[model samples]
Target: MLAVAMLLTLGLGGPWSGAEKAEAAPAFAKGADISWVPGMEAQGYTWKDKNGNTRDIIDILKNDYQINSVRIRVFVNPSNDYGNGYMNKDRAATLAQRAKNAGMSIMLTLHYSDSWADPGKQTKPAAWQSYTFQQLMDAVWNHTRDVMYAMQAKGVTPDWVQIGNETNNGMLWEDGKASVNMKNYAWLVNTGNNAVKSVSSGTKTIVHLANGYDNALFVWNIGGLIANGATFDIIGMSLYPTASDWSTKVNQTITNANDMISRYGKQVMITEIGLDYNQATAAKSFVTDIKTKIRNIAGGNGLGVFYWEPQASPGYNGGYNKGAWQSNGRPTIALDGFIN
Candidate 1:
């Protein structure tokens, strides 16, 4: 049995026992963009009161809700400018410090891109726009090292890190795409693995995939990594109930999540999850179903849940892509329904 399962089993009564202590299912070890706060700070987005009160992420966590760990994304340079919101190193430090001061852990997610990178799209960061395969590998190595050094030097070391985000399709674009060449993919992955191995030896490295409910894809993508002998500590999945027929699909996701532990002999976590609180009723339904689904997953195999951007007020156009940050005219739908 996996250690997480064993630990979870060694509890009061059986799984459904009300007396049993139910641990929180954290959506992301830290959470998404909020995790990017540190990087945002590095890019020059500061929280300054009209009175000139300089408060960074620590204030948000300290005031809004208590946080234990932070998840930060490293983009090559999202805004193209030297300093902008899409995660530069300086912003990450400030948030990391807040997490540290608040006695929280840190999870580093290397997006391998300058801007938004997800299962839907994997645009290679412009800086690496023209690098050869080998050059790209070096970029990954140097970038990871530089970021880790900055965090560690400031006394904020991450407890967990991800080589790339939702790497189901592959990262670093046409070059790192799965069909391009398995050897190339392996090389890119190893570059990140070695980077973490070099600086934060204590950190658990994670490799993430998207659409947890899709069983065959999960097997194929992660199975490929295993075949190539890629080393990582965690198998992470992103579950967005609103993305599909969630209730029916969640069962498959649970099976896939548990199977990963057996398949890889490693821990698993719902590295990214959110029900799209765009509608309160839907949000409630999504939250209730997700809570049940996650409990089942945790019960069968030790795992965690991570809600993405739960606290984010709806962005302009209701967080639609290419939209600005504008209120969605709804009450803050707390994604913490499962974890909190």
Candidate 2:
């Protein structure tokens, strides 16, 4: 009996002894871009937890969804357009403070425009439209620094800052259009990078682009930036796949993300991802697979995945249909992907 007790104590043999130590989960950021939260709230919208308890949106996200980070978009002099504008520096800083107070890492996306900036349109903010190349560079620097200062004054320093939003064809239109002049785009990217560093050297700067699965696009766009001496810490991607094609898209994105890591020798982040609001089941599967794949990237070069506006119910923002929230003021099961 003494020998058996020693064996069990030392884990030499026993039913529950010598159990393998559970490996700590990797620190892959699971987050959402809730830039639309303020606008939504202003419209008298509110959120509820799984238990039907009314709570602050951020509270619900952090406590219920296990979200570790939040992304906010900042625009240059946005209008009062509902769900379209109003992400100026002060507003952005307030949101950042809220996320920081909630113990969530913040990702600040500087659109550099008064409104949306994406693959289809990278229009310069109206104030910047008439500026020369040199003036444009100054505007980029000043704007970036100002926004960073605003956040800092609020005691909120972002963990990541995207220089531009989805610059597949390059940003600020004709002057910085990659197809027309890649070097100009590189200059703008470098200016933004420098500004971010000046404010918070620790913040990682991202050159965001759409279509994570398109290896050729990544090579052409990011390659252009590299060839023209652009500076950035991470390559950020945006991917939106429908319910039927998520599996294929996820696989392709993983392949592309690995290739980006190997080719660029830099980290990769899924800065934006979403599916139709009604497809909660498929969205859950999609998020789980993508998150797992991103976390498993070799050398831990895969940083994280961020869902775009997961709190928006169906048709909230001018018929936008990709959010993960249900119409009944609660999150759909889709966000369960973030759980370990």
Candidate 3:
């Protein structure tokens, strides 16, 4: 039993109950995106608990902080020559398995690109660059189906699946850019959602956008998706506030999230959120407050909050620095925000 506990603590073994385990399912999700785990591990980044004991970062979050879920990002065919590679389906599946074995709910986010896809850029995968808009839709559907099936084959059913990450501007470039062509974008989203349902009827589909603090943007983007008949179970947001305006942004995000639930009649999630290490206090306050507000959303429509790359290795050159860990692998107080 001690060995089992250690395995669970290290996230190397299947689920087991302890004093720390929640008596019931988490009322409001506490999540982290450990998508960079493989890359970080490959680069020889080590993680340890406050006591200085080496541990799996996922296990630390789940066992120590009450985090009940994890989010992973998948890139279709990312360049893997460098140790910094990501988005490959196989890597994602392996990580998903770890989360599943830890008994945490999994959220899979598909970028639908060969590299990063976000509000600023949504370049299509190179293989599909020559395909028409309709062909692109087919590709999206097939890829979604294949990924879902792959995870399912490993006994990892994603509780939530995001069609695209931070897609306020839309995905797949000009061919499926919602701002440029709402019809094509809507088609891609719906098709991706359908494919998720086909593979795992239990998985909830989400359409993510950046700037959770911007209500008008959500209104514009989500309104457009609805106007064009896009279907999804959840509306996802990426909330990253600077130190100067963190409180204001949090307030705005809460208001926006409530409005989205009331107007669109759909649930919402903080699909990605982060704060600088220097803002450790603010980070804790921000995470706790936003989670409280989300939990209090009228009708319980707010699903949860997820911190993006909270364990990011400082050595990586991807410009990510919102991790809750200090340089020595010990967690900063920023992670304390998840305690509640």
Residue 158 shift from truth in candidate 3, angstroms: 0.4
lDDT of 3 by residue, 1-340 (tens): 2333223324353332221211233557799998878777888988988798999888899988888998988888888543575757878888898888998988899999988888889998999999977678778877887788778777787888899988887889888887789877887887787677655655788999999988888898899998988878899999999877888898999899989988999899998888997678999998888888888888888989999888875545556678888888888778788886
| Clash pairs (backbone) in predicted model 3 | 75-87
Query: RMSD of each candidate?
Result: 9.9, 14.2, 9.6
Error of 2 at 194 (Å): 0.3
In candidate 1, stretches whose alpha carbon ends up further than 4 angstroms from where it belongs are 1-67, 80-84, 281-301, 317-333
Candidate 1, residues 1-340, lDDT tens digits: the string is 1222222223322232232111233443434346534334454554532234555545544344334455677776767543334667766666666666766667778888877677777788787889887678778877877787777767876777788999887788888886566556656676676666565555677888888877788777777776775666788888766535666666777788778777778777777766554454555456556555655554344445555644343442125221111143222334334334
Evaluate all candidate structures by whole-model CA lDDT and list the values in order: 0.61, 0.85, 0.81
Error of 3 at 296 (Å): 1.1
Clashes of each: 16, 0, 1
C-alpha lDDT of residue 111 in model 2? 92
Candidate 2, backbone clash total: 0
TM-score for each of the candidates: 0.75, 0.91, 0.91
Worst 10 residues of 3 by lDDT: 16-25
lDDT of 2 by residue, 170-258 (tens): 99999999999999999888878767766676688899999999999999999999998888899999999999999999999999988
